[model samples]
Target chain A: MSFSVDTGEIFGYLGPNGAGKTTTLRVLLGLLSPTSGTAIVLDADLSKDDSMRRRVGVLMENNGLYDRLTARENLEYYARLYEVNRPGNRVTELLDFVGLTERAGDMVGNFSTGMKRKLGIARAILHEPEILFLDEPTSGLDPEAQHMVRELILRLSRVESMTVFLNSHNLDEVQRICSRVAILHQGRIRALDSIQHLTSAGKKTGFSITLADTTQASEAEDLLSSFGGIGEITRNGNVLGMMLVTIHAHEVVTTLVKNGIWVEEARIQKRSLEEIYLDVMRQAEGDVA
Target chain B: MSRIMVVAEKEVRQLIKSRNVMLSALLFVGVFGIFTVPAVLSGMGDTGAMMDTLGFYLVLTLGVFMGYLFTAQVFLREKQSGVIETLLCTPLSLRELWFGKVLGVTIPGAILAYFSAILIMVTGSAFTGQTLVPSLPVLFHIIVVIPAFIAATSGLIGFTQFILGMRENQILNFVIIFGIIFLTTFIRELTGPEFSVTWTVVAAAFGLALLLILVTAWLTRFLSRERIITTLSE
Candidate 1:
């Protein structure tokens, strides 16, 4: 339910539907008050100090744009609101940054969902905020658009050194960009760790081995099944795939080779973020049951 | 520019872009000014006094109505669209946001009200077969009092819209429409032929508007970002 993001770090907050991800964001952004707790942002209690909000930026599920205004007008209005010096130039620069200079004069109501999301991101970074909060920024974006948004977030973190608090259920996005993450389930944090640690530190590991001799596939499978750490052994066309518990790929290969099985390739597969998330959710549900 | 002015200017620009709303306001003012005067002033005995009185009260009524109409567009529309959530995150205080929007609505509302006053004068002159000009009191009322009244009414409405939920705002809209209609028609009929459009009456109306503005300005202290955010339609 609570965590701290380091400076210049992209902290991904992952949760399922009705998991209070949006509600938590609203509280942190000072839109809603917590019933019995405090949310502090930028070394100030968000509920008490209104001025602290100037240092923060938010892009909610809605783009928060005036559809009647052109893209240029929408950005300029927000730039002025944030009191950015040289607002006209800033507006132009942001338009170019988001690749909307040609369509800056177009009304945002005419923009596609991806274009709207791009403009929404541009609006969020207009003030050069110390911390940016984005809820589902790339939720409905096309693959290319999603790449652009993710690249933009990385640029903000690396180039601008901006701290980003990203709330999303996109496991690939979290794995690709976030250094650390907190997974929420049933209004509680089930796991909070660095992406490296979450994906690497788990007990279950997978290994895929290809045999030079097709006849040795069954032999290799039997050899791994006889081992204490190997589980769920499956073989297909001289390839042996199995789950490893408390065992390394080297040991599996060494045992197969010792048993007169020729191993052509031995590879250790990393568990994906999606796997970690689903495992955590399943555990949480079993606990509830 | 200061943040308050920034917010106000944006509101003005957005309101200007809303062509349908502006066109409707003009059409409503034109219809009422051209049609209503001929029917009401033709039945009167002292046409000049009646015209003067009508100009006085009618302008104020139209000005308030204009304020009501535009307040919903500027304040309530922003809240409904969820743009206000982003604005609230700015350093701009709740009062600044409210006052800026009220100022935005008042400027356009007063301009439309002025056009309505002119339309009333021209249309009344044609219907009565005499050159009718607004008296000194009516002139002051149009030039000074009507804009102030518009600002006050819009401020009150904007404040209420920020504080109340969607259902309450709908009810408030109905009340505002009924109130404006009742005052415009029923109060004008109460004045007899002997009623004179004097400076005292003008001064009294100005004082009342000023008082209402102060009261509404004080009411803005009750506005909070939490209230506005919670009232926003999902």
Candidate 2:
């Protein structure tokens, strides 16, 4: 329910459907007033200072574009609204940045969903705002387009030193681009931390080793069962997958080989952001129950 | 350009591109301007006064109707499309948005009103077998008072569109359309053959329109970004 994104940080607001992600963004952008408390941005309450909005850029679910207007006109209109210096040049620069310069004169009504989404992002950063708020920025985009948007967000943060507030349900996208994230469920924040800390926090690494012999698989499991630093050793056919708490994959292989068990293949499996996110949601749900 | 002019210029361009609304405004003016001239000529003892009164009130009436038609395109369409949500985030205040739209609707509405005046002059001369030009007062009314009335009416209607919900706005539109038609016809019937168009009447009408503009501009204080954003279509 509450967090602060540091300057030049790509803060991901991750949540399930109806988790108040969009509502939080709206409150911060001054589209909706908070019921009891205030939401501030840029050292000023957005609801109180109208001029502060000029410093922020927003791209909502609707993209805030006119279909009747051409792609060039759409960006030009916003450029003028934000009062970007040399609006004509900025519009052309953005069109090239989003790779829509070829279709600049085409009506936005005829644009595909991905094209429109790209244009929406172009419009959001038209003025090179200090902070950008994007809601599901990559929703309905193809893999290539999604990658392009992620790269653009990274470039904006690294090159422009612009802070980004991204609201998305795409955990993989968040994992790739967001430096930190807050997972919300049922109108409350269940977890908030850096990607590195949350993914590595208290979770043991997993490994699956393929034994050369079916008979050695059970022996491998039995040996690892009493192992001091390993947990949850399971055997399926010739494969032994287990959780490694303190032992390394190399140590597990050496221990098996020293016991006369031939190890065919050993692979390490790290916990993903998706697993952490789902686990947090389940715990939050259990608390409510 | 100033933010108000930016918004106003965009509205004007977009409304001009809206073919259906433009054709309807032109059709409304053409039909009433050409057909009603004969009706006024049939009931008049003084042809000049009859032409003058028709020019004065009819232009204002048509101007208001045109404003009504264009207001929906400028105000309601933006809300329905949910574009106003982003606009609310801009540096422009609510008053600037309202005034810009009022200016946008007035430009086209006044142009159509001027066309209607010319149609009346042509059709009235044809019907009476003599040319009739409106007096100086009537000319002033057509040029000045009609555009001011158009701006006033557009501002009021656009304000109501922003404040009210969708279903309530639909009902309000019906009431406004019928009210404008009834008032235009009722005022003509009330004038009868003894009515005289004077400088005082022209000045009084301009004064009333100016008052309406000021009142509507002041009432924009009640409009909030939250209200418009919440009322916007999802």
Candidate 3:
């Protein structure tokens, strides 16, 4: 329900539909007043201070574009609203950045959804705001377009040094780009931590081993099942996948080789963001029940 | 001031680019301006007086109608499309946005009103053997007072649209259309053909328009970002 984004951090907000993600975003952007709590950004209340909004940029689900206007014109309109200096150059630079330079003069209504989203991103960052809030930025985009958007978000954080609060259902995108994330379920934050800590939070480590043949994998699985600290062992062809609780990867590899089970490869898998998100949702639902 | 101008400028540009709306407005004015002049003139005894009367009431009606048409586009269209949420995030104050849109609607509405005046005059002159020109007061009304009325009308409509929900706005829109029609008929009946255009009448209309504008501007204090944003989904 409450959190703060550090400067220049790409904080991902993950939630399912109807989890009040957009509602929280609206309150923070000053489009809606909170009923009982404060939503602050940059040490100023955006709802009260008009000047403070000049330093912030936002791209909501709608993209806030005039379809009648050209792509360049849409950016220029926002650029002027933000009082950005040299709006012409700034707009052109952003058009290139979002890869819409060739279509700058074309009407936005004619653009594809990906093109519109790209143009929306360019419009949001045209003024070089200190912070940018993007709601479902890559929703409905193709894989290639999604990659471009994720890369762009990273570049904005790393190059422009702009703090980003990204709200998305794309867990892979968040895992690939965000430094920290908060998972919201039924209007409450169930999990909030860095990607590293959250993925490695539990004691059980996912470990996988590939052997030379199916017979060797079967033998290894049986051997590992007999041992303590290893559970949920499943064998497919020459690979043995399991979760290591009290055991270590080095011990497993040494034991396998000593037992004459040839080890082709061994990998320690980290928990994915999708797994963490589902866990949080399950816990929240359990609490509700 | 600059931000207000920016918003105003964007609205004007969008209005101009709306080809279908522009064409419909032109057709509406053309029908009333050209087709109705002969019938109204034939019923009046004084040609100059008839020209003044037509220029006065007809142009003012057309101007306010233009305000109505364009206010929906400039004000309600943004709300309907959810772009107003983003605009609210800008540094522009609520008054500035309302005023900017008012000016945006007024400029084009006044221009159309001027065109209507010329069409009425030209059509009346063609029907009659003599050149028909409005008197000094009527010209002043066309040049000055009509735009003020347009601003006033659009300003009030835009303000209501910002504060009201979609269903209420739809109802309000119906009221506006019928109200404009009723006012036009009522004023025509009240004035009769004996009504004359005078400096006093023009000044009084101008005063009323200015008052409406001031009142609308004052009413904007009640506008809140939360109110506008909350109504957007509806």
Candidate 4:
């Protein structure tokens, strides 16, 4: 049992293309039975307790949609399969959410790739599932469609507090949206952590002092770099950036004022998610090699 | 329960859209109408010789072609289109999927077979110059045996479709359709002549149908995200 996720989360499962993301989704959806390990979904082992799938939703990368059926019909078919409580209302809501209310009558075969994917999402969430497994939620989609999908997911996550297990190779998307991320490389988790703790590694914990002019910035940089605790001081435009490698960040006020550089603003460089993801993958590759 | 039916119904609807299947069904029915129906009507002809020589030729050649297409392309289309990936991630088991597919083809195939049989009877009667009313037993045989033939053929088709990966290459599908036809005859001979073609086919159909159900159940034991992921990573 997981110690966390009880409070709800959008956990991103990051990996390269063809990294078994689809296969993992299959197992979660109970389409495929695992040979050895126990599959626990929604606190129940899928192998033993088959009923758990009823509470879970899955949007696989490929839509096994009935191409002959209209979009509305496709959703209706899945809605019945998932045993949705309010079939008509759910269908309407899903169609509207996916922005397919206009094309509800069109056959799935006629819908564009993105439209089909949106329909897939609608089908996945129609059952009001407690958990959703979305494999590459925005892959192959246009930028506009990608934004729509992202916004919809954020809305759903915030409002429903739904546990979303998103699998994707898009690192940027993962970094921007995921509250927590797990990197899977070659059938194992390379790393799993929150965004904040991951990027704060091997860096001076100090604030930057913003000056009004580049002349002030260069002077400040020279003065700060000379100080004993300040390791490396650089000037970015009017900003005096210093890496106080040894001293605590709180000591910046005293160090700056003593150096005669009046500080207008103080801030630290926050690490980006891409930086952490690359670091973890590099570590994993090194360890494996 | 409802999901399986939805899947099966959708498959049936797709049949209407397939120009290839429609053309194949029409060609097969037309051949039945042209050759056998005429021969049966001409009772002046030798019935035994026809059943022995021409009938076997027809059933083996055309039946195999039809059977192969029924099994191979039916599911292969969905697989190639990447649709199988969608439903496989559902709560549905493989057993239900197989049944839905079998029915999807069997219903339409059976209807086609039934009409072909009607042409056979009408032509046979006209040729014989007598009321060739089949007895109740024969009628029962026709009803039971004909559907069984189609069902069994569809089952055989399903196995080949799965084994051959019929979805991608149309050339492979042609090779498989003919290959299974020849193999069915070979497998039949190995089982022995005491079981005639009808019995052999019937038994084989029913038996293979049962085997398909089992294979599906067993294969599912290893299916999961691991399989897809492992495959992709490789």
DockQ leader: 3
Tell me the TM-score that candidate 4 gets on chain A alone.
0.87
Q: Predictions ranked by lDDT, top down?
A: 3, 2, 1, 4
> On residues A1-289, what C-alpha lDDT tens digit does candidate 2 reach at each position?
5678899999999999999998899899988888878888999888888999988989988898998889999998888888889999999998998899999999899999889988998998898889999999999899998998899889999999999999999999999999999999987889999998887677588889998888777777888998898988778899888888888889989988999999888888767999999999989989999
Per-residue lDDT of model 2, residues B144-188, tens digit only: 999999999999999999988888899999999899989888878
Candidate 1 positional error at A234, Å: 2.0
TM-score of each candidate? 0.96, 0.94, 0.98, 0.79
Q: Order the candidate numbers by TM-score, best to worst.
A: 3, 1, 2, 4
RMSD of 2: 2.1
**lDDT per residue as tens, model 3, A1-289:** 7898999999999999999888889999888888888999999889889999988999999889999999999999999888899999999899999989999999999999999999989988887889999999999999998988989999999999999999989899899999999999888888889999999889999999989766777778888889999979987888889999999999999999999999999999999999999988988999999
Question: What tens digits encode model 4's per-residue C-alpha lDDT throughout A1-289?
Answer: 1223443688888876655565566666555665567556777766454456677777777765777778988888777767788888889988998799999999888988889888888888888888888888899999888888888788779998888888998887777777887777766677778755666766665457787555667677666666677766766788766676777766766666676767777788766767767777788789989
What tens-digit string does per-residue lDDT give for candidate 1 at A1-289? Answer: 6678899999999999899898888888877888877888888876677778778989988898999999999999888877888989998998899999999999999999999999999999998899999999999899999999999999999999999999999999999999999999988999999999998876778889999999877767777787898889888899888888878888888878888888888888888999999999999999999
* lDDT for residue A222 in candidate 2, whole number 0-100: 84
Whichever of 2 and 3 has more DockQ, that candidate is 3
Taken over the whole model, the C-alpha lDDT of each candidate is: 0.88, 0.89, 0.92, 0.65
Error of 3 at A282 (Å): 1.5
Task: For residue B82, give model 1's deviation from the true position in Å.
Answer: 1.1
Who wins the lDDT comparison? 3
10 residues in a row with least lDDT, candidate 2 chain B: B187-196
Pairs with backbone N, CA or C atoms under 3 Å apart (clashes), candidate 3: none
Q: Reference contacts recovered by each candidate, as fractions?
A: 0.75, 0.76, 0.91, 0.47
Which residue pairs show backbone clashes in model 1? Answer: none
Candidates sorted on DockQ, descending: 3, 2, 1, 4
lDDT: the better of candidates 2 and 4: 2
